[model samples]
Target: MDDLFDDILNLEEQYYKEGYDEGYKDGAEAGRIEGRSVGMKTGFEKFLEAGRLQGKAIVWQSRLPSQQESSTSAGNSQQETVQTVPSPTSQDGKDSEPRRLPPLSSNPRLEKNITMLYGILEPGTLSTKNDDESVNDFDSRLKGAQSRVKMIERAIGEGAGDKGSANRNRQQAQKNENIEDIGRIPQRTDVVMGTV
Candidate 1:
């Protein structure tokens, strides 16, 4: 009887361990799947939001030149208040000065951001994932988009600071070169002074 009871207890112990192991495996898989789904969803949302912000910044930057031109025009036409507002008969009808858009290459950073934005936000990009699209691919794209957008934002925030400084330095260097040229006598290549 003792031996039989021991056998029954051992069988119960073995079955319990097997059931626990199965349950643990199932739970772990489910958790992993859930985690990946959540991660993908969040990554997509971040990409979308970043794309929108970048698009807006590009649009705003494009409009800056036009706005500045219009303001300058307005200032110049301040004396002629009536004519300042463009007439319907004028060329380009609605406005005497036609609106201008910045070229795609106007700002390299902006262009990069816009390109990245479009690539990520285009139809079927996030809406429908490709069968071959792996989680790592999605994550990589998300990180790329985020970084590019940040770069663009940083550039916009810094304004034309670096560019302006570069321009100033270039002009100064040109001035120095001109001064050096002025101080030096022109060498006559056609005449050999020592021989002559």
Candidate 2:
């Protein structure tokens, strides 16, 4: 009895140890997945920011060539020349002049596009119309799919009902045959009562 008790305790301890190890392993894997997802989110945000900055830089740079030519036109009036200032560049290829760009947060159009894109990517988000006709088109397609499903279900239900009716008839016929074969049963009372 003493040895059996010790053996059971040892088995219980081993079971708990194995359970703990598995739980720890699962937890570590879950933690790693969560960490990677967060890292991807952070990286995406940085990429968007860098992309925005690069876009701004390129747009401003494009206007420079035209503005420089217009400023050096030398055909404008003296007052125009005085008003127009030539922006100077630093020795290191960086612009010394500062230009103000519209804030990314203030662009309503871009904000709306971003919101729509996010909605498209994430489920349960608010739906927006890409266009007047496209929205209706999607709704129409959805309705078509639903109608097809309903038709299929009705066909299936009818098929199953037919099978059930046939089975019930078969069973009833079998029961009647068995009763008829068992004896010279006098069913005249019920038969006559039904006829009357």
Would you list the C-alpha lDDT of every candidate in the order shown?
A: 0.64, 0.49
Candidate 2, which ten residues in sequence have the lowest lDDT sum? 118-127
| TM-scores, one per candidate | 0.40, 0.31
Model 1, which residues run further than 4 Å from truth?
1-3, 9-12, 18-22, 25-44, 47-109, 130-133, 158-196
Model 2, position 144: C-alpha lDDT score: 44
- Per-residue C-alpha lDDT of model 1 across residues 63-179, encoded as one tens digit per residue: 554445676677677745534445556766556654444433356556656566557545455534534555456566666766666676565664334567679888988876865
Q: Compared with the true structure, what per-residue lDDT tens digits does model 2 show for residues 84-133?
A: 33345456545434343322333344333333333333323313444667
Residue 11 C-alpha lDDT in model 1? 94
Model 2, position 22: C-alpha lDDT score: 100
What is the TM-score of candidate 1?
Answer: 0.40
Off-target runs (Cα >4 Å) in candidate 2 are 65-196
